[model samples]
Target chain A: MKQLTIQSSSHAYDVIIGAGLRKKLSQKLGKSYKKILIVTDSKVSSLYLEDVKAGLPDHENLSHVIVPAGEASKSMEQYSRLLDKCIEEQLDRSSLIVGLGGGMVGDLAGFVASTYLRGVDFLQMPTTILAHDSSVGGKVAINHEQGKNLIGSFYSPVQVIYDTDTLRTLPDSEVRSGYGEVVKHALLSDMDWVKEVLSEDFSELSYSQLGDHLLAGIKVKASIVEEDEKEHGVRRHLNLGHTLAHALESDLGYGEITHGEAVAIGIFFAMKVSEKVLESTLPVDAYSAWLKTNEYPVEKLSNLNPERLVNRMKWDKKTIEDRIHFVLLKGVGSPAVVPIPEDDLVNHLKEFIEEVIQIDERD
Target chain B: MKQLTIQSSSHAYDVIIGAGLRKKLSQKLGKSYKKILIVTDSKVSSLYLEDVKAGLPDHENLSHVIVPAGEASKSMEQYSRLLDKCIEEQLDRSSLIVGLGGGMVGDLAGFVASTYLRGVDFLQMPTTILAHDSSVGGKVAINHEQGKNLIGSFYSPVQVIYDTDTLRTLPDSEVRSGYGEVVKHALLSDMDWVKEVLSEDFSELSYSQLGDHLLAGIKVKASIVEEDEKEHGVRRHLNLGHTLAHALESDLGYGEITHGEAVAIGIFFAMKVSEKVLESTLPVDAYSAWLKTNEYPVEKLSNLNPERLVNRMKWDKKTIEDRIHFVLLKGVGSPAVVPIPEDDLVNHLKEFIEEVIQIDERD
Candidate 1:
């Protein structure tokens, strides 16, 4: 097992990644918490909740709160219900919360754990490949009616257990979705890995090979998170593709397009803008072609309105003084965050969308 | 103007307490924020919103979101609406939110300011005497359906402007309620002030005198918050009468009893318990008689089930490992936070309730 630590102002925790790490949870968590609440999605609860439960020590009290699968569960209603569950079940400050699913479940559970009884010890046991990225970061939040993650806190978990064995049950679509985040990490930091992933068809990659990719992706993300845990500085670099990606998600409505898919498209557009504005050395056509090869909707630019998209970007949390900031690439491996005036950003979006539409017409 | 700085992690603000300090707001806030969202309740908005607006730097970007008056307004619905208002008003990360009301408005607006766009700069322009305590601390939250302050964060304001001029419009009842928190601060920290307040009949304390008490009370509370920002250690001392006080508010239904009235009863009960278990030096009979002399409900204990009250105390956030902790007094001046086992706490509650019921019969 490989152990990593997340250092934050309030507290720090260990992240253990390896096969069969679930078995060691009883030994690891027994000292800190006596009562544990396992929060998982319905699909995950049916398949692995019992196995995870069996790993807890015999003396430790345990309960479970099963939420429905998918992003819809990260709503205010669900968060309220989770609080009711904690109050009803008598989970106190010393009680532990274990998030046992993908990013959605982790985000929702992390939020519930953070606010419940003013805060509690939470352990992240991410079951999907995508969570390798989400689970490492301390950003936990639930969606409000206004926007996604509008209500949340920066609360880190006590420990994280990433068992490779859990990935065997994932659907192909889920795996593909997870790959988008992996590509994001690679694009932001590991250019060599980006080249390797782009070299072959993603369909040809084996499950074990995919695990290696996920681990590599997480390493890049983990390093950035360590330096700027609260996204005040270097951690904003991790939001390379997310600026446009979040706007796309907000405009299209969350859950219509997977977070990873939106990010993948955003990454493509960012590359184009970077090559134009930053004079970055990215071959934009080759990058777009690679995304196309992976079945990413590289031609979705025509469906999006540049004006509306620009307006949506204005609401981005990273923005300051009405200027939209973009994380641009200086080169293949080097990424830089720059703030562009609203009008300049709008003009760039208009030109980029026109170019992508022309490419679609040719195709 | 007396300037006091409250140092919290990522939140450091100065509390400028004096008359006419609101006029200097533009100089204090300067160009740090482009837009301002002044949040106040209907009553305070009608009274002082214009004064606060004039305090700004004549920026056309200023807006206001008014919530309803009273504790009932501090609900999730109000919090959600506040966020929606923020989105509609285009309050971004660099925007400023000034909470201009009593404790409820300060809490609700502070909560909105904390979570909207994942947090923005907030200033507290307290209009009511109660706000003197609420404004200084970074504790901002809306009440949940299940409990008070069940949903919130430790997000402090950028600056606190407590203008004594605003206190002139406060009703008699409002002034008395604000004194509850002041009395709590004194009982927990400063014995001299407690003696002075206890010596006077409730009717004799004028509104101006109440303001003086508030300033002194806030100093004690602020000092505690500065020492233990997160409530991990010394700050727990601030929760002296809150354990039972919160339970009473939840049981009686919010808005049924004023926060101060319930806290006064809780303080009386806590002193009795402290004398029973810790051999406290406090004159419990004299304290009980003083509460009665002030027309405070010293007989409310008979209506509550000791077991149910004890059960609620068990779920308190301060309780660790199922042991309920109390911030009891060695005397009026020296307060000590002590942990008592669940059974012992229940026994003390039962005995105290019986003693109070007997006292009521004698009266």
Candidate 2:
């Protein structure tokens, strides 16, 4: 197992990654926690809940709560229910909340743990490929009807245990969704890394190879998060494609598109806006083609109304003074945030949408 | 104006205490905030919202969201509604959330500010004397149906503006409720403070004299909180009268008694338990008499069943391993958290309840 220590102003914790690490849970968790609540989803609970519980200390009071397995579970209602569940289980200040599923589970559980009894000991045990990115940063939140992750806080977990063996069960679609973040991380890095990610066939990779990609994305995330845990300045760089991603998620309804799939689609527009607005022009064709080849469905952009999408972006949490902004790439490995007036962004977005349709028609 | 700078792990801010301090809001907040959402209660809105708004910069896009003016307003349902309000107002990351009311408004608005857009700039403008304690220490939260402040976090505000002028318009009951904390602070300090608090007449204090009392409580709270913001060790001492305070509030229903009033009664029993358990015995009769003379309904304790209140204490957020704990004092200024097993607590509580009835009948 490889352990990467994450440092924050509040506390420092480890992200332990390896194959079949679920069996090592007790060794990491120790005997300090007076109570432990394992929060998993309906699907992961049926599959791995018992197995995960088997690895916990027998003497400790262990319990589990499960929500349905989807983004819809990341709601204010679900958050309230989980809090009631924690209270029902009598999880106290010394208790531990084990987030034992994927991104949705981790986000929901992390948020509940963050607020229950003010805060509690939280351990993230991600059961999906997407969580490799989501679990590392301490951005725990639930969705508001108005926007994705509109209600939340920056609460670091006590530890993150990413057992690679769990990834073996993810569907191909889930795997591709997970790679949307991986590719975004690559784009944020140098051209060589982006080329490497584009050339790679994610489905065929072994657990070790997959771990390498996950580690790369995590390293990028951890490095950025360490610099600014609360997203003061440098942290905005990590939100490379999430502006449009959140807008799409809010407009389409949360469950309609996976977060990373929306992010993949967002990256295409971010590149176009980057080229048009910034002096540094990206080869938009190359990036779009990479997404298309990877089964990311970049054609989804054709279905959007530019003004509506840009209007939706107005409510984005990252905005300032109600002005819309985009994290545009100055070049590969160099991203800068530029505030575009709503009218200007709508115009640029219209051009981008036409280009997406033309590219779809030509192909 | 007395500007006490509160130092915390994240950021240090000022708690400006004086008469008519609401007029000083913009001078402290300055022109940086692009947008501001003032969250107030209906009562406070009628009294001070327009007046408070007058102090703010007119150039900024200022808006207000009003919650119902009571403890019932401190619910998950209200929290969800406020978040929607923020989204509707389009309060972004750089915007500010101005909490304008008593303890309920401060707590609910503070929680929303802490979680909205992950977090936003929060300014506390307290309208009640109880908020002199609540607004200062960074303990922001909303209530779960299971318990009071069962869901919360330690999020400090940018600044706290406590206007003594606002206190002039408060009902006599609200002023007494506010003193619940002021007197508790004295009990947790020393004999001199306790004596001073007992001798003081609340209804006649000049704004300056009241500010002096609020400053004393804020100093004690600020010192303790700076030492332990998340209530790890020393900070638990600050919860001296709160164990029974929470239980009574939960049992009687939230709106039945004001928070400080319940705290005043809780202080009476806490002293009894402290004398029974600790080496240093308190003059329980003196404390009970002071509470009775001060209009605190200490007799309410007689109505409660011992086992039920003891059971309620088990659900307290301060608990560990489902064990009952109390911030019992050895004497004034010396408090310790003791883990009392259920049966022992039930017996002790039974004795205290009987004593309360006897005192009530005799008087």
Candidate 3:
């Protein structure tokens, strides 16, 4: 088991990564909380709710609330229901809420916990690699109908327990989706980590190998978060590929494409934009080849309209005075925000989309 | 203008109290925000929304969202609508939300501002005297059907601008309601202030006189909030009469009774309970007389069941492990948390109800 401590301004918590640690949660949770509500998604509950229950303290007051699986669960409707469930179960300020699933469950549960009775103690048990980045750094939110994660807050959880055993159940698509964030973290952190990741076969990552990569990503995130918990300065670097990523998700209609899949394509566009605007020295083609080798569907970008994508990007929280602020790389591990004029951004996006289509036709 | 700064752990902001300050808000908010959403209730909008809009910069992005007046507006339904309006209006990270009304408007808008886009800057323009207390302490929340302020967080506004001119339009009942918090603040802080308050005719107080009292109340609140922002210790003392006040409000049903009037009765019972439990040498009869003179309806408690009221108190955030924790006073200005046995509390409440009836009949 490897444990990392994240010291944020509002909270300090541990991100515990290990195999089979989910079963020992009750002992880890201690005896302070009188009421425990385990919130999981339908998919995760079907696979691991009983095991999670088995791990909890043998107290009759312990209960569970399940939200439907997928991105839809991260809505205002679900948030309200979860709050009602907390009140119905008599969960108090001292009661604990354990988020037992992937990113959706963690985001929903963390948000509910943050707003429930003002705020309450909550634990995150991330079941997917995509959550390795999300489950840390205390950014929890539900999506609005207008956009993804449009309504949310920065609320840190009490602890994050990533049980590697849960990863065994995830589909290959989900695994690839999780790697999108892993690749972003690598880009923002070190070229050596990026090289190490490229050297490995993405399809056959061992549990130990995934754990090591996740911990490295979390360390990069934790350090950045500790410096700027509210995203006043350096925290914007974390949104490296998210500007285009969110636009794609919104334009494509959320849940139609996986978050990491959109992010993988977003990273590609961010690199191209970086080369055009910042004169970045990044090996964009090499990274593009690596993404294709990992089976990330970069070819899907050809189907999206540049104008609609740019329009969607206009609504991003990072946009200031209608100028789209893209997190561009100067070199490996060096990310900076440069405002792209709308006309220029639109032209670049159109060119990139055409190039992606041409490359796909050649292949 | 009387200004006091609140230094909470999460945020530090000033409480600016004066007449006609709402008209100067645009100049105050300055160029920092590109979008401004002025949130007010219908009553406040009818009276002051135009003045508020006129004060703001000549920016087309400024908008207003009005909720219905009163406690019913402090619900999950309204909260969801407010969020939707925020997203629809495109209020971003650097935008502003000005809460313009009574306690309900402040609570609702403050909560939306706290959660919108994770969190955004908000200004509180309090229209009621009760809001002098609510608007200062950074405690923003909407109500759950189960309890008053059952779901909320400690999110302080950037500034609290209490325009005393707006108080002229408030009904007698509203003024009385605002005094409940003032009396509680007086009790929690200074005996001299309490004596001075009791000596005044609440019905005929001038604007300047009310401002003096409100400023004193805010100072007491600001000092306590600075010491314990999250209610870990001394901050709970602020909830002195709130325990029974919330119970009575819940039992009578919110909107049926004014919060301050209920708090006035709650204060009477709290003192009686304090004397019975702690042998507190409080001038209970004198305080009871002052409440009657101030037009507080103490007779309302005669209609409530002791057991029902106690049950509602069980749901209070202050209640711990089933033990009833009441903020009782050893004497004036010396409040302390005292856990009473259930049987003893019920018996005291029944007897106190009888005493209030006897006193009313004598009057």
Candidate 4:
């Protein structure tokens, strides 16, 4: 098992990545907290909630809360209902909360644990590959009616248990969806990994090999999260594909497209923009070919309206003073945070849209 | 003008309390931010938005957002609408949000400013006396459908401008409502101030005198906020009256009573508990008489259902693992944070209700 730590002002938690780590939680937590509140999604609850509950020390008090599965569950109404559950269940300051699911569960549960009773200790037991990215960071929040994650706090979990065994149960589509985020980490930092991922056929990669790649991705993300937990400076680089990705998610209607799928298309657009703005040498055709080989959506760009997408991009949480900032890449593994004026971004979107449409029409 | 600073990981802002300090905002902020988004309730906008706007340095970048007046406006729907407004207006990272009004506006606007683009520079331009408490600490949040402030963050403002001149337009009930929070501050920290406040007739305190008390109360509260920005330890003391106060607010329905009025009754209950639990030497008769003199609902406790109030208290954000903790005072100015087991709290509630009913029947 490899152990990594996330240090933040609000909390410091260890991320343990290995097989069969779920059984060790009781010994790991000991009897520090009086009781434990385990928050999981319905999907995870059916799969591993019993394993987690059995793993806890028999002496410590425990209860479980199961939320609906999906991004739609991370709303203010759910958050309020969860708080009511905590109160009804009598969770206190000395109690601990274990987030036992993927990123949505982790974010929602972490947020509930963070704000309930002002704050409480939370353990992240991420059960999906996507959580490899979300679990390491202490950014806990819920979505508001206005936007995603509009209301939340920066509360870190006490420990993050990434059991590779959990990934075995994930659907193939989920695995493919998570690869987008994994690719994001590679694009932002690991050129060697990016080259390796590009060269290999994902269907041929073994489960252990996939775990290794996920670990590598998480390490890159963890390093960034460690330095800038609140997305102030260096952390912005981690948002390499997020600019267009978030816009696509909002424009397409959130939850309709997986986060990773949007991120995949976002990375494609980001690479094009990087080539244009930073004069970077990108193997665009080769990259596009690899994405197509993997059956990823390599030509969805033609379906979206450039103006609406651009407008949606303006609402990105990272924007400042009417100016939208893009985390562009100078080269693979060389990311730069750049503030592009809104009009300039819109113009760039128009040009990119026309280029992609012309290519699709010729094809 | 007296200047006080609250230093927290998310926010470091100065509290400038004095007459005519609104003009100093432009000088204080200077060119640090490119634009300003002033968020205020309709009542304050109609009265002082122009004066506050005039205080700006003629930056064509300045704009304002007016929300409806009252706590009802601090909902997730409103919070989402505000984010849409920010996106439409192009308020960015370098933008500044100025919250102008009472606790409702401060909490709602502060939450908007905090979450807008992850966060931006927020200033608290408090138009009501109650904001003397809300503005200092960066406890910005919007109410969720299930409960009050169920979704929020600890994002502090950049500066707090408490213009005493604005208090002249405040209704008498509103002014008295603010005194509840001020009295809470004094009761929790300054025994001398509590004595002075109790000695004087409520009608005798002038606006300037009240402002002085407000500043003094804020200073005491600000010190605690500086020590514990996220309520890990000392900050919990700020919720002295809030335990029962929040329960009352929730039970009676939020719109039925102002925060201060609920808090005033909460303080009375807390004091009673203090006398019971801590065996503190409290002038119970004198205190009850002072509350009566101010037209505070010293007898309203009889009307509330003890069982319902206890049930509602369970939903308090401070409770953990089904245990309710009360912030009780050992004496006036000697506040203590205590965790009460569920059964013990229930028993205390029973006793408290019985006493209040007995007193009401005698009257």
* Number of the top TM-score candidate: 3
Where does candidate 3 clash, by residue pair? A118-B152, A152-B118
TM-score of each: 0.90, 0.93, 0.98, 0.83
TM-score of chain A of 1: 0.92
| Worst window of 10 by summed lDDT in candidate 3 chain A | A315-324
Rank list by TM-score: 3, 2, 1, 4
| DockQ list for all candidates | 0.42, 0.78, 0.72, 0.28
Per-residue lDDT value at A120 in model 1? 79
* Candidate 4: count of backbone clashes, pairs at least 3 residues apart or interchain: 13
Q: Whose TM-score is higher: candidate 2's or candidate 4's?
A: 2
Instruction: Say which docking band candidate 4 falls in.
Output: acceptable
Model 2 interface RMSD, one decimal: 1.2
- Residues A1-363, model 4: lDDT tens digits: 777666776656677888877777876773477778888998989989888888887544788888899899998678767877776666666788889999999898887886664467888998888788888777777775556776566778888888888888987557767888888888776568788777757677677777787778878987887888877789888787887988887877877677887787788788888888899987677667666667665456667777787777766654534677788888887888777777777788878777766755565
Residue B72 accuracy (lDDT) in model 2: 84
For all the models shown, what interface RMSD does each have?
Answer: 2.5, 1.2, 1.6, 3.8
Q: Which lDDT tens digits does candidate 2 get at residues B249-309?
A: 8888777778888888777777887777776677566777766766777667767887888
Candidate 4 lDDT over residue span B243-337, tens digit each: 78888888778677778877877877788888888998766676666766777654556667766777777766544346677888888777888
